[model samples]
Target: MTLDALRLEVPDILQEDAASLADLNEQLAEARLQPQEHALQQVLSLLFRLNRSAMTLLERQRALQSFSEEYRHYAAAYCAGVAPPILFVRFCAEIATGFKRLLLQILQGRQPSRPHLAWCLYMAQHFLAQSLLRHYQLYQEPPASLWRDSHLLYWLGEHQECLDEPVAAAFQPQPANTLRGLYQQMLLLALSNPFHLAEGESPLLFSALAPLASLARLLPWDVDDDAEGQTVDLTESQPCLAYDQAPEGDSHYLRRFELGALLVALHEPAPLQSALERQLLERVRHHWLGRQQRRHARSDHAGDCSLVVGLTAIHAQLLEHRPGHCAAQMLDTSPGGARLLCHADQGRLLPVGQLVLLLSSSATPTLALVRWRHLNVEGLHLGLRYLKGLPRPVWLRRAPSAQTHPGVLQSTPVQGGGWHHGLWLPNEQFVEEENLWLQLPNVHNQAALPLPAPNLATPLVARHPLKLA
Candidate 1:
């Protein structure tokens, strides 16, 4: 589709010599004072207007890069804490719009050189990847338009590249310019269980995968190829279309990716920074290879449950004896997890990877993690994984003079059905192996050692094994 055919409207901000870095900086300064959602909207609009203005190809590149860097800051802030659902959706839409604009420019032969075109393509891919990451973060299905745009861009890239031609982007540590390379990155992100990722973890995971993304092989979807574990429909924007989801017709547009080479690279020894990073890479590998076997079978369930979200709210409800803040209807239940449906308004308050306390008439209060979430006209659907043990709210402090913090002490089930004591404290509040005083109900302060526990899918809290000191 041509730019004129798309009929994108030009913003009124267009003017002679208006799309300069100085003008962008001034507007960005003003945007900082506004609310985060509004500020992001305004900045994105300003960037789009600048890109559409009369400027050299080089100038447009600089403008796009600046917008990207600035937007990264805003995205980090959003990832660090709870963001409004409207803002999150808008963020994805704006990223797509910006990417679409760039793709149109490249398709119209606005690129002056092959190298410059490659850079533009990289920027476009970056924008698309950002949108995809945000969607996966919330476990929301991407709209059809996103896949349509992606197909268009991939077709363009396939025609432009020569055999084994290396395409590199400015400031990118690894080259990912080929159609398969770029597309594989998207596939890896999709396979990554982003719903369980902690705050700011998505970006780190992506960076780690950049060097290995090209190792994955993408081929035309064929039902006979068992090697190709995951399938993606270029015409639809749903989750990975596994073998069962493949349709009878339109198999040509379906693409399946194999993770054999990528898994090999992951298995090799590398300079991974932390245990967390290693764990994340291992998880991504498992997902790409379709090795995530369900331990429990889900059964249909019907009931209503009340819940309190976040560490502070759950602490207050359990310790202070306050009522749950929201109600949800149980959809399904498994030994490991359960699904619930709640009002969209209440669901927006519970982000993925958050801690929650679920209460029902039929069952005792259960500690669970918000594993996945989806919103629709009816309400919000949440997938919740139960924690290992029941929790008791308690107050904790590092020293007698230090202010107290809310925490949860639980008897977590260990291997062989034995139970081990652990503490769930607000994120960053506990230091490994450090001594802390735990205040229990109607009891004196007890000394305990805060040792690291297995990483649970709780972004707002840290889990630590407790040892009597």
Candidate 2:
């Protein structure tokens, strides 16, 4: 029963500068980018593990510093027009990896610690993404390979833990559907559900489309529009519109149910790349550079909001579907109660209302509620909660029925979007330090501060890359 409600006080946090970010945005966009191929790729996988490894303070600091500096040099070179296209892609990937590393530090730290450094890493990640979209044109062909790693799927939940500090405890018992289900559904969606598409050849392509259908259905709509958790004129009901300017002049109504964020934070970035790239890029710049310039742009206040995204893992666990379960493990259900799955690949059975922590960390060991929804030939649906929306600004998805059961272990990949609004705590709530979070409000939480703004230009002064040899 670790899925207890966590209360996060919406802090009147320092906002990332929008204009300065735009400047860096331009630099990152124009830089040529290329995908990682050799040593760098293997190293990236290693770094993610090193992120949570037991290392000395100096070792940890140096690791983060070196990682960040690499991106800076990449950026500096991009500005000088020397980096390659694939390098640009590597740069973005590295930066994202770097941010993920920093974010882990923040989560692993004691609660109530200065988070300025963590915030800076957050901003850097933002800027790096700016460069990513500017150069890649993600949607044309998303760097699918970038997020193929299941373990590194999307450390979105970490970001959620930071943003929704207080209200992070577990919520209504429900299973976290996770990207595995989405991908599985995507793989089989077209074949099983014809209404979603006409005909498709690519299996993964169909798997990719399933989530949009899921998002379309998650909207807080009045009409059933055919509630079987499927079938809806998604674009018609909520009608994709910018945050600041509402489509029908009811912009205020648009903010309800934390809609803008969930899609941006938890869903795929490729789909929204075309539409939200600009805003997202702007936000990234602000996070890293803390600068903004005003220019008349079209609708869609894309940037300038917080975000959380959930991506599928390139490597996934094998779950077999059968009886209660093909094997004998746990099950998970979608928010809409349509899909179900288990932790083990060989599909298994569930005892009952089983509550378990999704992402258990040495720092912030948080749990999620799970339940057995259905056992079709596809998979088991474990009702989930906690992931809908963190802290506050809960999503309008139907809450799982109040139920409880034994416990187990599991993890889900996720990412969040939207920083513009939520249950924000006024400035009075925090004890500040160059804009970071600290535990006890008055104590020093060393882990919260970022190692430093990385300057990749600082040659690998040490022989061992991450350490001062």
Candidate 3:
């Protein structure tokens, strides 16, 4: 279904990007022989369409299957040499769109069976190797013998621990220096479900491919932790952590799954001796080592205090929660932003790059962007970065006066604390308890503030211009 049918709004940036790509497509069409900007637009357009469109769990899966089938046809044609140059572009487009869709589906609670997962992996490898081959042929001035020592196969061979036995064997049949063997190996790896095999399952391929693991740890698996799926209720509203059901976690684990994979490759009985492979390995090692020194600092204390965040109009579909604001507990604070944990069973929210409104009692609402998200058994640990300098509330900005701090008004903290670990209420009474209260900074002021919570226990139901003593 279209975005309109799901009542989802499309972002202007996406539309502009698509429009720019359309212009590029026209240019490419004019110069048929020019491989200047081959298929980048088509790949991105497919991604945009898939993300913007709202479909049921079933429909999304089916759409991905269709793309996979289309990719298979292209792969076959390309193998036969009868495939046109554009077919390579089409194949990559399908690969990009299909792989991204599969990831999003997993986030939205669609678990693929083992066979289906295998198919996806196969398709990913086939398209990726071909795309690289095509890029070198058309864009780069590579030597004719480049195919004799396919760098792509060399790259895949190092990560055999991630491939199932059947998939690994797929590579053995191909003679050295052939692309077909590498493609066949990856395809077989995708077709085989080594879920039952201890060494075969690596569902976190995206993180391995990520540029950095420290700041953007996409998804990490706890080898011993249960992998059961969490039941989500899209219609239910999550109570504040004060209501007692908040998930618990002090620090987000920051281990490099790729680093672990790399170590295995290094320890292999027959390590890669190729100069090119050695150079790539050394580069990757140095890069990750540098990342280790640049880790973000996290605070140890965000105790009992929760940070209330609201969904802003200028957000992507990534973090769109049910109709209104949702509350998140601060796990820790960093110099630029903070890490928070929110109830995931309420439905997955907060993908990277989503903008959210951070409401602080003493300060103005801070706008933050989701930088990273780690899904766990408890919920999602989101890493956010504030967009601008932190602003103080109007009252905090002005000198405190006796008239503004009436005793009666000060006596009653609008709401008592709830079961949430970090309970934020509408009044300052609970402020000393490491709890945060939200309200207009100025009591005498009637202006509508950009923040959401007031000094009342029922801020969720409270209106603007809250009444204070």
Candidate 4:
């Protein structure tokens, strides 16, 4: 690709290394006689270089995809002592940090430190996270997956076990699976090593360590959000939830975390929560919502459960779940019904207006907001008509963007036009979705994305996913 191409559409997508990547693969094939110890190291280096170049090529998505296998394998081996993974991890973790910083500089439009140099460092460590995190479970191997076992991770801390309470009225509980615990783990470990690039320290020397530093920040998954259903206006009588539901924790905790990150410390890590704690809290909310659901037994009323999640610690959602149709008895007894069509899409996202329109789905178009469910009421409603979809909402898709790259935990940013998980470090651009970067015609504002035509499947470049511990 031409240099202008790099500056233009996919500034980070580096394809020049294709032949080199292929050459390394060939070398791996022929190194059959090499000692397993040396072979493993060589294999990883080659894979890392390939991945790094992908980042350079704006093939972050592909690089990440390619790196997953090597990433996990080496990680599993290192933690398990099957290989010298600890020292290796430490090395990579140190380097990863620099790459992350470079991403930030690029987003900020500051001159890139060792331009075209970071692609290698970041990818090498990133793939390591992919390879290792899966086996993070193996590191604490036992009866089953860590997803079901709290004993999978436990440490004896000298300090108090309870979290340091905030200095304010605690906010409501977050949805269900904030995935904070998993995210934090990624952050702390990836940055496992930190160096003081002091006065005498060379920029090249520090730059060389970026990939390792970045490793500490490799996040495996986005925050656990339920598939979005349709978003709802708080004023409405009821609101629909993200089909999957939302993460759990103190609503205030998440709110505080977001508030802290937005304007100040973008590199800092948030808090953590456990499934056991989240589950217990959900039970409490079920009681509070005055709705109970049995495992096997169908509820006389579906989804009577309610919960709240906020966007930017300000956009609050008090979502409730109920039967798709009216109460069972009412559905069977009611005779005639009305038909209406509701617009699935919302009009312009009016910043200030509390617009609630339920495009009726029967025969004619209609807009209706929820009113009190009086005992005298009569009607049959199929699905809900909320203003928007839930976070972790089903079909959670990032809208098309103009350009893209690999950085941070790769969370879908929770902004509009799509979900914003992570931010673009180069320009300080925080895109809700990966494609958003590709949607921008110009990467100048750091707000717009270069998107392909809506009909075509936008090119998804491999983004090195960062796991923020």
Candidate 5:
């Protein structure tokens, strides 16, 4: 499909590149030998395309299941020590790739049934947490994105299950530092009923109201919340709930009548009950308002620097071929979102509301929602809201800008290339998700580079530095 034909319209309707993706999937399925690395990437690219397509929920589930099963087999073999190293590596990478695509879909507000969502979530957790994590410590140059992304996926699965079932955990009163923690806290804030905290609320009320907990999960802080059904505004005469005789169309109302009734009973209550209710409301307010305010917070860094940002489909684009990375100029970043400038060609294709992965040296790759786009004299400016995560603390310095090359684990590139003056060093600690670097020092003296013993030496690359030359 032509690139211009790939523009993502609001209320996303992605153009399917089904023929090419199907062909790639067919090739992958039929391959008997250990497929090449490019083939693995092709499969991942195809999976991305499929998720972006306008497939029905069942169709998407079936297709995803088929791909998940295929990779699981490879993972099983790799764990068994039978699969080739290349195949195993590809399996690990593809699992991360698939999970990211799944998350982007979720960010787009694609609602699948609980069972189907559970199945997909289960597969993702199995691949990333249960399988890939076991081998994560072994890689010398792992993708830093994996550490944070995996945690997010794990929490999403856990959250999906716990929304209806007994919550396996409670909200800690502590501030959340990570994206996973923030989401975990949000789930608890949104789904936990404050009235249930009373010691003797009565087993009868809890038992009768159990089902409502499943269907009426409410986010009291949401902006679209009905004014009449707001929790804080509940009264004895006008409880914040749709009555039993309410119209069928009002059934989806966010107000939980059962919970609201209990809230009214405890509204003027014993100190303990009042305190618990206050605490719940405080958390809800904090997170809700925090989300809005963080989006526009100030940043100290320059907004026009070249930041290494990863890009997936911001909605869906018809690419003749998938590009390795997106070149985006960092415009501005707040705790909640970022503004980026990109070439018109790339920016025009991204649809507002689509999620994309933005990677940088300062922080792990973030899943961000496209909120707005505009063309001006400067370029195509895109606004992105970070999804369910906060950026790293502002005080922590971002790594300085430098050229980087991705290398295979435990291996180094050959010498004689650009930036040879700097040694290939592993992180002070062996972090499986951070990449090894070929750093160039300002001194430019070859003798200053750390030359480890042969056994410890990494592969070196030999390319002339164009500017230096």
Candidate 6:
């Protein structure tokens, strides 16, 4: 069926001069005046209408480019903390709908020009990537409808022999040439467990995946194919299905992809340009190819606990006995980590990598890191990894003459099984390779400790583990 037969009639404003860029600018200016969420909805609707009304492929591509630009603006705002989470999610959904409709329009009967076809496919892949990112951020499953649409698009692209056609968009850092590259990129990012990333890091990791995606490979799957890994069932309306657990029946739509090339690229030193990039690559390797198994097994646990978020709040609660605790329910637990559920409002303050204190009636207060998080209709779900040893409140400074800052002193097990002490201080107070003075509670003397490079750092805090003689 053709998209035109399924689409609603274009609005009056778009019918006459849908190709006119000036009209679009004017309408967008008016949209900016409305509330952000409402404004985005209107803008997206107008852009799609413009695309639908276009008489030529050039006009449609122009409209799509404009759509891409406006989407980037809102995405940046959400990442910068200027826009609310609800608006970000709505923006993703609207853009995905717009892209799907436009792609269907492009794929109809008459073959489009190569450039236009490539651009549409590229944008479709981009839209899918963003949708996956939204799901990762929300800790929700990607809608099956989205996967169905994506599979259909890929199937059609393959039939047209345009899956690898190259297209360059101004917003992208590099040319997006292949639908398979983008598809594999999305899968790699998903396997990386992006919910564990700190705020503002997801976008960077997404960008990094663009260049490396080409190294990954996707192939048709057969029942006899002996690859003992994950498989993509193009016909299944599911997200991230496993190879072994695929449906009992065989179908031509089954496919498999390998990340060997990508893993080799990650292992090379040259591809890692920054520490953060290196860390993200390491995580991808660990999740996809590394043989490291979970250190501790988890069991179902049920109880309520009090939680305090952030290094500042934790320090205040521990040292000053301040009232910053929020109620949370334990869902499951292990010696190494625990999963908890809390109200969304409380979860907002606890981003991934955040330092939180868990207090329960049966045990003493425990320190943990926010390893991952998800929000849904019920509430916020948190995955926490416990920090070793009991934490004691301490005052830290560069020197005795310098101003003191609140910090936590804790001991963690070293590789050979000895305890090593570290200080957790707010990000602003941490200095690389500098010596810091620690003032212990009820002690008159302050101890001088050399601050080694932090093994773990987040936007809110840094952990400096000290090596003693």
Name the best candidate (by TM-score): 6
Candidate 6 has a TM-score of 0.84
Clashes of each: 0, 99, 16, 127, 10, 0
Candidate 2 local lDDT, 1-469, one digit each (tens): 1111121111121322211222333333333243334434544444444543555434545565555544454444333222234545654555555444444555566662534433433333343333323232211122433322211221232334432222111111111133322322221222222211111112223223333322422234343232222211112221123223323433222212222332354334565333433332332322111122333222321111111111111001111111121221223223322122443332222222222223312213222323223333454433333322222111111112323111111223235832321111112222222233212213333123212222211011100001110
Overlapping backbone residue pairs in candidate 1 total: 0
- What TM-score would candidate 5 get against the native? 0.28
* Stronger candidate by lDDT (3 vs 4): 3
Candidate models: Cα lDDT each = 0.67, 0.29, 0.36, 0.26, 0.39, 0.70
- Give TM-scores for every candidate, taking all chains together and pairing residue i with residue i: 0.76, 0.25, 0.28, 0.22, 0.28, 0.84
List model 6 lDDT by residue over 105-218, tens digit each: 676748677767666766766776677676666566667666666666666667667677766654432324577677667767766766677776666676677777878766
Q: Which pairs clash in the backbone of model 6?
A: none
Backbone clash pairs for candidate 5 read 310-359, 412-458, 412-459, 413-459, 413-460, 414-460, 416-462, 417-462, 417-463, 418-463
* Rank ordering of all candidates by TM-score, starting from the highest: 6, 1, 5, 3, 2, 4
Which ranges of candidate 6 are over 4 A from the true structure? 1-22, 29-42, 48-62, 72-85, 138-141, 172-175, 268-275, 289-292, 398-402, 412-419, 433-435, 467-469
lDDT of 1 by residue, 400-466 (tens): 6589888887776668866787777777766666767778777775655455654552666777766
**Clashing pairs for predicted structure model 1, backbone only:** none
How many backbone collisions does model 2 have?
A: 99
- The sequence of per-residue lDDT tens digits that candidate 5 reaches over residues 378-438 is 7667777665432211110113344433211111233675332121122232232333223
The C-alpha local distance difference test score for the whole of candidate 1 amounts to 0.67
Please give the distance, in angstroms, between residue 434's alpha carbon in candidate 4 and its true position after superposition: 64
Candidate 3, residue 42: how far the Cα is off, in Å: 28
